[model samples]
Target chain A: MSKITSLADLKKKRDELKGGLDIRVKAIDPDSVVQVKVAMATCGIASGAKTVMEFFLEQLERRNIAAIVTQTGCMGYCYAEPTIEVKLPGQDPVVYGFVDLKRADQIIEKYIKTGELVDGIIPVNYQTIDFKE
Target chain B: MSKYSMHLLVCGGTGCHASESDAIVCNLRDELEAKGLMDTVQVILTGCFGFCEKGPIVKVMPDNTFYVQVKPEDAQTIIEEHVIKGRKVTRLLYQDPVSKEMISDSKHMGFFKKQLRIVLRNCGFINPENIDEYIARDGYQALGKVLSEMTPEQVIKEVRDSGQRGRGGGGFPTGLKWEIASKNKADQKYVVCNADEGDPGAFMDRSVLEGDPHSVLEAMAICGYSIGASHGLIYIRAEYPLAIARLKIAIKQARNMVCWAIRFSAQSTVLILNFAMEQEHLYAVKKQH
Candidate 1:
């Protein structure tokens, strides 16, 4: 409501607004939050990116973890339908293929929460980092 | 913001406000409250959503849905048809100017598809004038991190390792400069931020001070600490009045943070910037990662 008067007051305000702040900050600066991108191209949709994306949205927040889940064009992995990319803060973006709900859960538990790599990783076909994508 | 079943982001930019986005926000919140859905739904009055051609943008979060050209009267239908029934308001959906095809998700729309948000973090997500919104997003965490745990030499080394260059036309290494200043032994050293980019096209500094002012202040404090300077000064242009106002608010907000215990006399002053074309397209990208 006004200028923050003390450290205690600032901490209180931060906690009070943590939920909304997480939703907004995860998007603007996803470095600290888990960044998930669903492949939503025609091929991806045909494979079930829609279900995978929805499952991510409902489950990530339900698990009380902050994440930004958005749809993106094909990452050129057509064979792997319903592919998703997970980028942890300070880490390079990792693409996972054949993502059903079960794999999605494992991703949340092992990769996102525990920082342990999960299975379903697809090797990059080209030099994407050089393109500054 | 947390675990909300739905979030309605209404554009409160100059254009969308003229289109009565305020009424849309009020009505949407009313509809949610009337239906006993306030606990699950959040109505945020955000800045321009970048799609000025389709002003009065209303974005729904968690599902990543976009409703464009919304009216005050569309509130009931949005809540009932879209929010409650899980159906989209087809009439309010954004149509591509070229293809004339409706784009429901912003990620798929060309207007937003090619975009990446790095500098303009909180432009449309939070009320720029509100200090609380700024603090909510870990605004001063960096300053806290630097002062509590880092020595001046340690901070300078980290900056050197990060390879951060100047933000202006000249990409000078920031850490090298700080290391130089810290080595200069003086009773009263100084950290000066030369913010006066008088050129018409240079506006990154101005927009950041306006939208996410606290971040600039935090960085300034960190610089002051790293340079072993007790004083921080900002040289800003006066032509930009909004930047000036927001900088004052940011400075005031930063002063109230828990800096007294960590660092002494870590205060800052301001400057200005300008960029031409599409200045109000600040809210183009939703936090879609």
Candidate 2:
């Protein structure tokens, strides 16, 4: 992907993909769906999240998986470049550390395809604190 | 199944990449293959995992051993001891600057133990572009609920009640903004996400927009319905080329689902939607009350 030079080009590319794009809707049957999240924070990008994100999009499209790909800001784990979280509906979401194109492929093939937990997971570090208190 | 396996995830984030994270990745692959451990081990290059001060980081899987401040030269030893013999390289573990203890896992470290990730919920967990992974996490449920059972007013009420003040600095009540926009008499009102997050050291909105754009999209539509606006605008900064590109992709995806008709309006100025709520009508209604 070359640098997007203008908003018009951006719109043009979006329009071209419009017909093929598959945005996820709220699953009436949530049990059937899978969710993948890529960290797109500055830290993530400075870490190469762009490439990681692109790889997942391409793989998902090729595999014909009915999943929704999304981006989120920093998770504060800046040391873990290209972080990704996976949620296999009804199971707790797990955060995977240090993801790239190759790891993404394995994740898609193994975790997303076979539902087997693979390597590269960062253990839960923080406890949720109620800020209101 | 292999008797023993190790997966090495190398940090490919720009900072580390600039510091030869890519070279380190290549070297790891070469050394792993040279040691004939390629079949038993896997070396993967991944996006930023944060903790950027420690560049060229690697996490060995299964045991989840995190190694920080790795160099291209160290890849050989990592392959020899860690990958070949399954020995933990204690020297490479992340040492807390404060505690001075070599912390092997990110969870036990103070840097990772104090944050709550609601908006950043999915980052560093799944591939950013895979939707199934998102669906597995209940990604679009909010949008579905809003579209099916809740009226726009009800959606607005929920957001208002959720206590999610705008993360965009001003702390303006998001629900109230929707309420005002909903009351507006414009035939075409707009809902805008201020992805032009310009705060110093602030990448919150960018990460939300990047990692879980659907949440923002779902939230935006909920806002649109609440405010009776069918059109949406995302005012992202020009500085973030990657974020802009991803957001464009997200908008197209959103359109495919018929969630919202979105337009990317590129401008450097702070974005403020001109549509005003029908103030006179609200005041008149208040008078009647």
Candidate 3:
């Protein structure tokens, strides 16, 4: 690490370092940011969930979308090993099954950006107690 | 800024360390490695979270899940349930004493909700060991701004106008003190930071030093710039081993950044002397006295 010679250099250093802690900053009001949760159980990992998760983490930031990518247990879709659930602010979370890098990109560009429902969505088969009650 | 989507911040404060937070860190790393999710998740040992009563605390970022009293053995459960499944460990969540309801977020906690953190703003938030993390939070920006934009008189006036007072019980105006010190015409001047907390149960300074040592160092540098002192001395107690260790690391990193470097701003030479590092010199002074 070189010494910051001037104020401009310090500001540049700060900007370069900001991305490292961006997730924590966005997490403050999680309801306000795009929340992406990739299922990462044994079956999920076996089906390339790790790659899918990494793609979202890298792509969302690179694309300038405010998103929080996290890992979740099995979504009970073993057939779709690398399944992901994306919850946009003020909308119901949509679970997309068999999510590859291409599917994830489509989800971000189409479903996330334009709200156009893509083909791979796993319809909600079960309801929580909030719905049951 | 690596592609890590998740962050697990384990409290590395003395209080948490006593409860074996180091073992928790190791166990968490081992579990993450076993699951092959190491690249996706980043585990950082952070300073005090200020909730030492319920520590050792392990806070998960990007979701803001606060887990308290985290045991080393529970690392597997955190990785399996929280990190892997997106489900929070209810057993580890800080339950409200009154409602008995599990509070996952630290912001909503009864203890932290009402309090606004100023000086301790970056305490539990950033990795104290990593200078990049500190810089990410605008750590030395204040010093840079003061050095680049303001004159010594302007800096002192700004501090005075802000109604900033010394933390000491006397409530002395800090700007006035600086003015007084600056008026003294001497060949050599010294800005002394009193870090020796002798009052019983007073751990504020220690916490600040341990949690955010760079902030203290930056403030010292700012004071040096304001009072026209080329040399700064931090009179800290040897009892605070963790604070001392962190100060040494922070000083080294800041020196690398050139803010704490002997030639600060490339125009002035402000050397911050860590008294803990020069025990022999202090001993010599004491023997002479």
Candidate 4:
């Protein structure tokens, strides 16, 4: 670690460190950003969920998308491994199954970008109590 | 760069530490390891959450679920229910004392909703031990700004306009004091931070030092810049072991980042900090309101 001799150097260092805590910052107001949760249970991992999660994490930042990608346990969709749930700001969370890298890209570009409903969206199976009420 | 998807921040304040928050951290890590979610889910021991009455607190990020009074044994439940399933542990959430309502987010709580944190803003959020975490939250920007952009007069003027008073009772204007010191033409000038909160039940200074030590160091540097001082000293009591330990770590980390390094070749204000403990009884007696 070199000494930050000037204001520019300090600013540069700050920018570099900002990425590390981006997840924590975004967590403050998650309702305003795109939230991606990839199922990483044994079944999901066996079906290449890890790669799909990595793709989302990398591509979202590259595309300058305000998104957070988190890994979760099984969503009870064992048959459709590599499953992901994407929740756009001010919208219901949509779960997609059998997601490869190509499908992940589509989710980012189509569903996440333009809010256009795409293929491979699994219908909400379990009933969740609406906390908003 | 770590690709951690979720972060679990456990409080490591003196108050929370007494309640076995350290064990909670260990148990959470073990649980993550056992579930093979260690890589994705990051468990960090952060400073105080300021809600010590119900501590040890465990806050989940990217979701902002506030879990209060967490025990070491509850770590597995947190990992399984919150981290893995994305289901919040309702029983652990902060319940309103009056309404008996479980509040998931700390922002919504009445205790925090009315308060706007400035000095202790980063207290509960970041890991104080990590220099990068401090930098991420704009830690030494004030010192950088003072050194590069503002003159001593301008810095003094800004402080005056900000209306920040001395925390030590007398409520003296900080900027006036800095200007008075800066006017004195001395070969060597010193900036001293009085961290000796000798009063019983007064833990404000200790909390700041433990939770956000870098902030205090940066403030001292800014003060040194404004007052034409090259040397700095913090007068902290020896009783605050955690604060002292954290201050030592913060100083070392600042040195590694070259925060205390000489800015220019000439007129280098090499701000050196030393801890001083003396006359606790006199200070404590004087501090009594």
Residue pairs in collision within model 4: A27-B62
TM-score of each: 0.59, 0.54, 0.87, 0.87
Q: How close to the true structure is residue B82 of candidate 1, measured as C-alpha lDDT?
A: 67
Off by over 4 Å in 2: A1-133, B1-48, B60-62, B71-85, B252-289
**What lDDT score goes with residue B137 in model 4?**
96
Error (Å) of candidate 2 at residue B102 is 1.3
DockQ of each: 0.13, 0.03, 0.52, 0.48
Candidate 2 lDDT, A5-109, residue by residue in tens: 223333444444432212312222334567677777778988899688777766776687856555556777899888988888788888998997888889999
By summed lDDT, which 10 consecutive residues of candidate 4 chain B come out lowest?
Answer: B262-271
Q: Ten consecutive residues with minimal summed lDDT in candidate 4 chain A?
A: A1-10
Best candidate, TM-score: 3
Q: Write the per-residue lDDT of candidate 1 for residues A45-91, one digit (tens) a residue.
A: 88888788778888888898878776667777889888998988898
RMSD of 1: 12.9
TM-score of 3: 0.87
Instruction: List per-prediction Cα lDDT, in the order shown.
Output: 0.70, 0.63, 0.82, 0.83
Worst 10 residues of 2 chain B by lDDT: B269-278
Sorted on DockQ, best first, the list reads 3, 4, 1, 2
Residues A37-102, model 4: lDDT tens digits: 999888998999989988999899989998988777888999998899999999999999989998
Q: Supply candidate 1's per-residue lDDT for B274.
A: 15
